[model samples]
Target: MTTQTSTQAQVIPKFGEQKKAFSIDKLKRLVNAAKSMSDFDQAKRYLCSYFIPCSNPHGVFMWRSEIKNLEHILDKNISKLICSITKVFYT
Candidate 1:
């Protein structure tokens, strides 16, 4: 005679919706304003203060890659703004 064993796994419940701490509208406005700036110094100041760093390197790399890939999609003015922002924040 032969005997067989079986195992069962436990399931976890999914969490509910999360609330954001910052104001999306305000952030959008701020970013839009920064994008419109003609001076690099002004744009750099705004981005350095407003954009926070992520803990993960992979995420950051992906974000940079995405930005590069989408560069053509953004307006020329916005691209200059982003370049200044990146120079300030990444450095």
Candidate 2:
């Protein structure tokens, strides 16, 4: 007996057709869409930068986190949102 596994290809949207500025709302929407499709979008790798201590220069170095797989967020739902927000805190 022989067995085989089939694979499917993902269709990436044709972006860059029109020049446009990056919008936080748009990025968030696209990332959310990609999550439902079980696909990976390079744009999901954007970095989030914020200052700690809920202050400006008074805070230490800027805190940064890589926006990894949307699955992490999708799995946790709002809990992940809360955690990501709390991560802005300093060590």
Which candidate achieves the best TM-score against the true structure?
A: 2
Instruction: Tell me the spans in candidate 2 whose CA falls farther than 4 Å from its real position.
Output: 1-18, 36-38, 45-91
Q: Pick by lDDT: which candidate is best?
A: 2
lDDT of 2 by residue, 1-91 (tens): 2111111232223322222333455445434444333322433332222212323323222222333211222332433333331112223
Put down candidate 1 lDDT per residue, 1-91, tens digits, no spaces: 2111110121211111112222334334344444223433332333333333344331111112223321122233343334432222221
Evaluated at residue 16, the lDDT of candidate 1 is: 17
Model 1 Cα displacement at 12 (Å)? Answer: 41
lDDT of 2: 0.30
Record all residue pairs in model 1 with backbone atoms less than 3 Å apart, i.e. clashing. Answer: none
TM-score of each: 0.22, 0.25
The worst-scoring run of ten residues by lDDT in candidate 1 lies at 1-10
- The superposed Cα distance between candidate 1 and the true structure at residue 70, in angstroms, equals 27
